[model samples]
Target: MTEPEGSEPAQDLSDQDIFAVLDSDHRALLELADRAATTGGADELAVHCEQLVMLAVRHFVAEEQYLFPLMRQHLPDGDRSVHRLSDAHRHLESELRRLEDVERSPQAVGPILADVRARLVDHVESLSQAFASLRGEIDPAEAQRLGDDVLGVEQLAPTRPRLDHSDSPALNKLVSLVEGYVDRIRDAYTHRGVERDER
Candidate 1:
């Protein structure tokens, strides 16, 4: 996984601590989506929408690679719980893709972003409850390790959502790597989430 320049390692963080990252990111994305929905100017809307989507991409990937699997392994009726959460993620991604397509159209984008925000809120609540349950069951040392892994994987996660993915671990890793590389290249070229003034 690629690390940001001058970044320090995750310092003895527990799984509960890792959930803080998710909470912060969840707030950021919802705030961005809210801005996208309310902003009048198309350019401003596009900027917020792109940022929301990028944040969601990384957050979702980190959870899928680390948090969700832990839930499936540790929580009661874990498989079914994870399936519901994963399906919610897929639906959110689909809505985000639509938001991307109509980014320049304020009327169309507003409703889509609103829907995305609602879905995100619901998903976050569900995941939070699952994690709370898992926290009591999982070992402290293992949770710490998973926390570090979640942070590490997020740095290398794709900045764009990919719909066509398999459940196979090997294939998922390969797809994540390839997509992350391509998305980084595209973001570099287009300055995807960079503010217009900075660009």
Candidate 2:
């Protein structure tokens, strides 16, 4: 994924704190949103949307599993903030599903895409504010430890949306593993086909 202009180079999550990792994901998502907004064709728009969905699912899963719980523990009003964020997540997920169908008719996707972008921008801003508050209350070491925990959660997170298993981390991880295998097989097939065509 491309880093946003003026952003720092992408680094391994192990090398950065939780804020940095989340910021990176937010920037990448914004970039995808911009691309989706400007895409000319249905195919191109659909590709951007798909990338957005995958990034969003993984990002949310990591946050829900690691970051938010920590926030709830550290921040005074974290419970309310986290609840609001969770509601936004559900709304965004629903929009993502609609986007999949809207992409099939490119003309119909513009408004929905705009809505998604707006919601994402708002969500990112809220998260940044919450993290800033969190950082003030915790030591750097604790923040770094939380970052490591987030990295671990991300490792097992699914790239695709798990609508039915939203509340079950185990199920989501299993589905993600299966999805990863399928994606690898599909990618290999496509690569081989391209190579044969070139030959």
Candidate 3:
């Protein structure tokens, strides 16, 4: 599949590593959060907020599909770690959905956005700690293979949060296939409108 427009070129998973992939996503999310927090206009805030949610959803799904399972196999106390991360994922997804609703309403969303930002920061810190704990637990080659698997999963991951379904990998993939197509169509439509407005 072709890389989405505006996405970085697909990296060789063996050479690139999962940490780099996840770090890139985390940076994009932090930047989006900053923009959302600072933007004065509701329309601009909404756009940044939407992008943040999409990226977060994709990142979490990729970890669930590939990273956590590998951790379960390699890390000590892996089950507890995966459970903690999964809980955080669910909470974040719920918050994103709430933010979406608030965005659509006439109500002010500054406080909600702030709360989301705080949660995201905490989540990233916890994830970093988990990764650090995994150092020397698995071979570098095995880690690279797992990272490659995650990259493949990410290519087909949903760009929208899916809070309604159970967290099964198989189910997530099926739902993502449908949601990813819809997201692409919506993005294309929005881009065309922007181009028309720019003319």
CA lDDT, every model vs. true structure: 0.74, 0.71, 0.70
Clashing pairs in 2: none
Query: Which is the better candidate, 2 or 3, if ranked by TM-score?
Result: 3
Candidate 1 CA-lDDT value: 0.74
Candidate 2, residue 35: how far the Cα is off, in Å = 0.6
For candidate 1, which ten residues in a row score worst on lDDT?
Answer: 1-10
Number of clashing residue pairs in every model? 0, 0, 0
Tens digit per residue, CA lDDT, model 3, 79-113: 88888888888888888888777744225667777
**Candidate 2, 1-199: lDDT as tens digits:** 2343334676666867788788878888888778778877655566667667767777887787667777788888988987888888888888887876564455687788789889999989898878888778877987788778667666555555556544444565566667646654754554411223242
Give the top-scoring candidate (TM-score).
1
Q: Higher-lDDT candidate among 2 and 3?
A: 2
- Rank list by TM-score: 1, 3, 2
Global Cα RMSD, each model: 4.4, 4.5, 4.2
Candidate 2 positional error at 34, Å = 0.8
- For candidate 1, write residues 1-199 as lDDT tens digits: 2212123443333344556556656766766676777778777778778888888888888777777677777877888987787788889999989888873787788678779989988987887787688778877777767767666776677888787756554666678888988898999899997778888
Off by over 4 Å in 1: 1-16
What lDDT score is found at residue 22 in candidate 1? 68
